[model samples]
Every structure is written in C-alpha cells, then in structure tokens.
Target: MPRNPATTTRDALLAAAREEFAEHGIAGARVDRIAARAGVNKERIYGHFGNKEKLFDAVIKDALDEFAAVNTVLEDDPVAYVGEAFDRYREHPDLLRLLMWEALHHRSAALPDQSWRAERCGRKVRSLAARLGEEPSPDVGRAVLSLLGLAMMPLAMPQLAELLGAKMDTPESVAAMREHVMGFARAALEGRASASG
Candidate 1:
C-alpha cells in the first residue's frame, strides 16, 4: 500500500526534528532547517504541529512514548528489565540526547504536559514496586529512577563513562556493564525489600 503523503511528511519532519533537537535543543532548533532536512515546505511544520514549541513537544512525547512502550518491569526477572532498558538506550542513543537537550533548555521551567508525564512516571514506579514486592512509595520511586539512570548513563555520557573506565563504544563492555547494572539493581531492590520487611 502506498503511504499517505501527509503521514510521510510528518514522519520526515519528526526524524529531522529529532536530529535537530538532539543536536541543538528546542530553543536552538530551526524550522527552516528541519523542513529542508525533511524535504517538505516550511509551512507544513506549522500546518502539522502549530509552531516550533509544539513541534518540539510532539517530538519529545513521541520519543518517550516509544521508549515506554518497549521497556517494562518484569516481576519474575527484574534484571531483565534493567538489561532491556540499557539495550533500548544503546539502540536509540538519540532519545537520551534529545531528553538531555530538553532538560538543559527547560532548566527552571516546568516541562510541557507535566501532569501527563508525571502520571506515566508514576505508573512505571508502581510497576517497578510490584516487581520488587513492594507498594509504590518514595523508596520505590527512587529505585525506579536510579535503575533508569544507571541504564542510560553510559550512552548518555560516553565521555564520563570512558573516563570512569567503561569502554562505552565496545559491545563487550556495554554487555558487561548491562550485567553489572542488572545485578546491582537487583541487589539494591532486594536489600530495600528486606529493610522494609
């Protein structure tokens, strides 16, 4: 089946926007450049996304939604959850860069759709808590956040990882780090559960 031109254009715009935003951030991204890279007219950006800020929000929402869809916490094998997250970040490094750019640009201001994002985060924390045999609480939330941060660290900051003795560019090193993170997360969660019990 032939693809719809509008959908094709939208996808291209999004791809171009991801690269731009990942490299330059929201404030620095240019609609003209995005359009040129996407091979679509500049007006299509406004027609599709309303404006630059809205387009940025759409880009980030799509990236995060995709990430959330692919990664899940497993009750039986929690280590696999962390391993899968690390793999996801390895495969989609741009997402981390885009998120980092968003954080840098939105330093003091609240992010767009804060309530929706928070609700999604709450769900993940609850899921992680369930896997750890605990109810959702501040500790569970912190654990969830820590595990995710650990998974993303090597990809998000290759230079730092390298400086700290991790070979961020090597598949073997990444696999080893993934195993270590999974073991570390498992122990931490188990320790927390024991402490609470």
Candidate 2:
C-alpha cells in the first residue's frame, strides 16, 4: 500500500523538528532550519502546525506517543520495571531534553495541551498502581513519581555522578547503575508493602 505524501512529509518534518527542538528547544528552534533539515518549505510547517508554538505542541504530543508505544510499565517484577524505565530513558535521550525545555519554558504556566498531558500521566499512574497490585490512588501516584525519579535522575543529573566518581559514562557502567537503581527501587517498594501488610 502507498502512504500519503502529506504523511511522509509530516513524518520527515517531525523527525527533523525533534532534533532541532531537542538541541535548541521551542524558543530557540527555527522553522527555517527545521524545514531545511526536513527538506521541505517553511510554509509547510505553517500549513501543518499553524505556528511555532503549535509545532512544539505537536512535537511534544509526538514524543509522548512514542513513549507510550515503547515505555510500558510492567505489572510483574516491579524492580525490573524500574530498570526497564531507566533503559528506555537512556534509549531516548532527547525525550528528557524536551521535557526539561517544557519545564523551563512553562514554569507554573499551564501546559500547551494540558488535558492530553494529564491523561497520559494518569495512565502511567494507573500502570504503576497495577505494578503494586493496588488500585490507583494518590499514594500509588506518589510511588509512580518516585520510581520514575529513580530511573531518570541519574541521566538527568549526570554531573553529580561524574563529580562523585560514579561509574556511568560507559555502557557497562550504565548497566551496573541500572541494576543498582532497580535494587534500590525494589527495596523501597518492599518496605512499603511490608509496612502496609
């Protein structure tokens, strides 16, 4: 089957825009550069996304969709779940950069597409709750946040790892850290489960 030319162009634009936005963020990303990289006219961006802010939103939505496809939280082996989440973040470095840019730009302001973001977050909380064998609640949501922090904090703050002489610069070192993080996370979950039980 043939794919639509419009879809192909949109995909190209999105791929190019992802790299541009990841490197420069929304305020710094240039439509001209994105178009040039995507090998399309800048007008196509306007035609497809309406404006720069809209394009950023599209990119964000696209990134989230990508995550949902590949970053499922596991119901079994919650510890392995944490390890896998860390692996996923390592695989998608730009995602963290995009999220950091969003946080810096939005501050306390509302997200570009608040409802959609909320839904995605809600789904993750539910998934985390399932891993704990509990119904979704505020406590489970907090656990979800903690587990995600465990996964991403290392990559997000690599300077601390380097300053402390932690082993994370190499692939083998990262794999070791991933196991440590998983163990750390599982201990937390076990402590809570024991206390509650």
Candidate 3:
C-alpha cells in the first residue's frame, strides 16, 4: 500500500526534530534547521505541530513511546530488565539527552504528556511488583525508578562515568556497568522485600 505523504513528511520532520532537540535542546534548537534537515518548508512545522515547543513535545513523546515499547520490565528477572534497558540506552544515547533537555526546558512546570508518562510509570511499577511476587507498592515503584536511573546514569554522565573508570563507548564497560546496576538493584529490592516481610 502507498504510504500517506502527510505521514511521510511528519516522520521526516520528527526524525529531524529528534536530532535537533538532542543536540541543542528546545531553547537552542532552530526551526529553520529542522525544516532544512527534513527537506520540508518551515511552515509545515507550524502547520502540523502548531509551534516549536509542540514539535519538541511530539519528538519527546515519540522517543519515549519507542523506549517503552522496547524495554518492558521482565516478570521474573528485574536485573535482565535493567540490562536490556541499559543496552537500549547505550544504543540510543540521544533519548537520555532529550530527556535531560526536557527537564531543563520545563523545570518545575508541568511537562508535555506528563499524565501519560505517569501512567506508563505506574504500569512499570506494577510489572516490577509482579516480578517480585508482591503487590504494587511505593517500595516497588522506588526500586523500578532507581533501576531506571541506574541504567541511565552512564549515558547521562559520560564524563563522570569515564572519570570513575567506566569506558562509556565499549561493550565490555557497558556490560560491567549493567552487572553493577543489576546487583545494586537486586540488593536494594531484596532488602526492601525482607524488611517488609
């Protein structure tokens, strides 16, 4: 079937916007550059997304949706879940950059798709709870959030990871980081479970 031209253009614009936002963030990204990279007229961006901020929101939503789809929490092994999430982030470091940019741009204000993101987080907490054979509680939520933070730390602070003797670009270093993250998460969650029991 022939693809819709509108969809094709939207995809192109999103791809261009992702790169721009990751590199320069919302405040620094230029609409003209996004249009030029997308090979579309600048007006199309406003027409399709209303404005630059909206376009940035769309880009973030797309990136996060892709991440959620690929990195589901495992029911039996949280470590494996963290390992997979770490690998995905290693492959797509831009997602972390984009997230950092969003935090910088939005600050304390309500973020775009905040409710949807919260709902997704809730689902992850439930998944983690099921994995641990426990009810979804604040403890499980914290563990899930902590594990995600651990997975993101290396990419989010490449310089720090490197200064701390982590080779951010090599597979072996990433594997070692993953092992540490899994062990840390396992110990914390196990301790929490034992305390509660």
Candidate 4:
C-alpha cells in the first residue's frame, strides 16, 4: 500500500521537531518554528501531537525506533553491539543533546515515556546479565550502565574529554577511541588488562 500523506507530514514534523528540541530544548522550543521547519501549518502539530511536550516525546520515540532498527549482532556479541552503539552516538550527537534537554526539563517529574523506556532498558539489562552467566542483579546492572556510559561520555561531555586529552579531531582518533571503548568493555568482562595496554 502507498504511504499516507499524513505519515509523511508526521515524519517531517518529527525530523523538524528533533532539530528544534535539540537546539532550543523544551523550554526554548517554539511550535511555529517546528511547523515552519516541517513546512506544515502549526495547527498540524497540535492535531498530530496535542502540544510541544508531546511532540518532543514523539521525537524521542522516533529516535528509539531508529536505534531499535539497528539491532545488529547484539545476540551474537554484546561487545560488538557496544561498539556499534558508540558509533551511533558519535554520528547522532543531536540525540544526546535532545536527551540532555529532556533530563533538564523533567529532572524531578517522571519522563513522559518513563514506563516504555524502562521496559526497553529492562530488556537490555536482562540480555546482558544472561550473557554474563548471571541474573540481572545490581552488579550486572551497573556493568551495563558502565558500558553505556563509556559510549556516551565523550559526546555527552566533550569538554571533559578534551580536558582528559581524548579529543577526536580526526577519523583516526575517533576509531581509536571506539576501539578503546570496545576493548575496555571486553577486558572488563574477561578480567584482563585495560584498553591502554
């Protein structure tokens, strides 16, 4: 079946809104700007999403869907999945910015998609624990968190990375850092030396 024009409009809105939220954050984002970027009337945003907060949530869901679509070799090698995840974040720094916005806006309140996000993360925690010959206990959970933090820290805190002299000014540096992340994860799991070795 042919794709509906409404779907096209919704996708355009999501793309436009992702950029808007990433740049301006929820408090700063404007509906008219999002609609203008999407090349649709602002009313469509209200019609399709009800409001700006809801639109921002939808953009996050769209990003989650995009990542889920890239579920490569996770079952075969969780370590390789870690490397792929690092690459994904490196390529989509805007997503990280959008997340920072979400964290800032919803610091105390529950996220709009809290339940769904928990369920999604729960699956990964379970998978990682099973791969390590254990249940999803606190230790395994912390390990999974470490893996994600290793991938995200550079993008999420580039100033810190720069201060630590881990700057990725070129492809070679990026590749080296990605390899270090994967190697560090593998080494941690295998009880071996650090990636620096």
Measured by TM-score, the strongest candidate is 3
Give lDDT tens digits, candidate 1, residues 40-73. Answer: 8999999999999889999999999888866455
The local lDDT score (0 to 100) that residue 121 gets in candidate 3 is 87
Candidate that scores best on lDDT? 3
Report the Cα lDDT for residue 29, model 3.
Answer: 98
lDDT of 4 by residue, 88-119 (tens): 88888887788778778855677778899888
Instruction: Give per-residue CA lDDT, model 2, range 23-121, as digits (tens).
Output: 999889999999999999999999998988888888888887876665345565667768877887889999888878877776466777788888878
Q: Give the alpha carbon lDDT tens digit for every residue of 1-197 in model 3.
A: 99999999999999999999999999999999999999999999998999999999999999998788664455667777777888788889889899899888856678788899999888888888887888899977887878889888877888988888886576677777889887887787788779878
After superposing candidate 4, which stretches have Cα over 4 Å from the reference? 73-75, 107-109, 192-197
Query: Of 1 and 4, which scores higher on TM-score?
Result: 1
**Candidate 2 Cα lDDT to native:** 0.84
Candidate-wise lDDT, in order: 0.84, 0.84, 0.86, 0.83
Give residue 100's error in model 1 in angstroms. Answer: 0.8
RMSD of each: 1.9, 1.9, 1.7, 3.4
Per-residue error (Å), model 1, residue 174: 1.4
Model 1, C-alpha of 138: deviation from truth (Å)? 2.1
